[model samples]
Target: MQEPTLLILTALADEPRHGYGLIQEIEAISAGRYRMRTGTLYGALDRLLSQQLIAVEREEVVDGRARRFYTLTGQGRAALAAEAERLRSVAAEAERRLHVLRPGLQGGAA
Candidate 1:
């Protein structure tokens, strides 16, 4: 899965969020490394909705504006779990290789 998609799923894993909330959550999750544009976020949300990975948990009108909150589906939870495991495995292997290459090195940076 793409990084943005992964982040979105992760953000929704804990609780439902509206589009703007998702944008903030994603930015915080990435430690400010990624700033998602509104258009991009909505597009991804639509795609995930179609894929059945996410669903609209609720909709409300606040200050005359409609807000749709999204939550992760069972499939989305499973997918995110799998992706996290895969990433962990890859990182572990990279760490092991790094150790072999530099016996005294404990991590990636010097």
Candidate 2:
């Protein structure tokens, strides 16, 4: 999964979130590295929800607006962990290659 997607998953790992809350959490978690426009955020949410990786837990009204709260399913947790492991594996391999190529210290910078 892409980092943005993984980041959404990570944010939800903390708690269930509605659309706007999820958006804010992802941005915060990324240290402002990621900021999703509504279009892209909803697209990713739809895909994950359809896959049963995330589910609508409930709905609430705030300021007369209905908001759907989403939570990670067990499958979602597993998926997030698998994605993280995959990234870690690839990162480790890349660093190893960097060590061989450049032999310098940015934790084996290439």
Best prediction by TM-score: 1
User: Tens-digit lDDT track for model 1 on 1-110?
Assistant: 99999999999999999999999999999999999999999999999999999999999997898999999999999999999999999999999976685555656566
Model 2 vs. true fold: TM: 0.79
Clashing pairs in 1: none
Summarize candidate 2's per-residue lDDT along 38-71 as a digit string, tens digits. Answer: 8998999999989999999999898999999999
Error of model 1, residue 86, in angstroms = 0.6
Worst 10 residues of 2 by lDDT: 101-110
Clashes (N, CA, C under 3 Å) per candidate: 0, 0
Q: What is candidate 1's TM-score against the reference? A: 0.87
Candidate 1: lDDT over CA atoms? 0.94
